[model samples]
Target: MATNTTTKKPAAAALAETAEARPERATRRAPAVVGPPLGEGQEPVTVTLSHHHRIDGTDYTPGAEITVSPDYARGLRGQGFVART
Candidate 1:
């Protein structure tokens, strides 16, 4: 039997030519999904907040303050945030 002298084989050559291609993106994605979109005049409110303040580490009150979107403060309401007076 004759020994194969070719170091570059078809399989090895194809493997060398293969490359990982990435698709080009058109436009940038919108903001990360903070939550669902609000109505014409509404905002988003983060429900189920943490009692302990991450800033001061103090036990805050439920009625004292709550995190909400600016639009929500106007009229937009999140999934479960309720407008308070």
Candidate 2:
């Protein structure tokens, strides 16, 4: 009595060899900035809200001192937020 069965490689070639041994991971979009960034003659600058923020409704607690502009303070300093120069 002997039994041996091995045959599995049809799932799109095992997902293309696990996506080529995996090593791409570099997709992190979502930084295009929105409205209410002190438009109309723009010239605000001075940003420093490393955390809490609101906007139009106004809140901006965390280290607040906002005054956004300059392309929304460079899109809130690329999200990490930290501008004052």
Best TM-score goes to which candidate?
2
Alpha-carbon RMSD, each predicted model: 11.4, 9.1
Task: List the lowest-lDDT window of 10 residues for candidate 2.
Answer: 29-38
Computed on alpha carbons, the lDDT of every model, listed in order, comes to: 0.43, 0.67
lDDT of 1 by residue, 2-58 (tens): 998987659866765663344555795423223335556655554333233232233
Name model 1 segments beyond 4 Å from true.
1-19, 23-36, 49-85
Model 1: how far is 25 from its true place, Å? 11
How many angstroms is residue 10 displaced in model 2 relative to the true structure, after the best TM-score fit? 7.5
Give model 1's clash tally: 5
Stretch of 10 with least lDDT, candidate 1: 47-56
**Alpha-carbon shift of residue 19 in model 1 (angstroms):** 5.9
Off by over 4 Å in 2: 1-7, 10-44, 54-67, 70-85
Error of 2 at 51 (Å): 5.8
TM-score, predicted candidate 1 vs. hidden true structure: 0.23
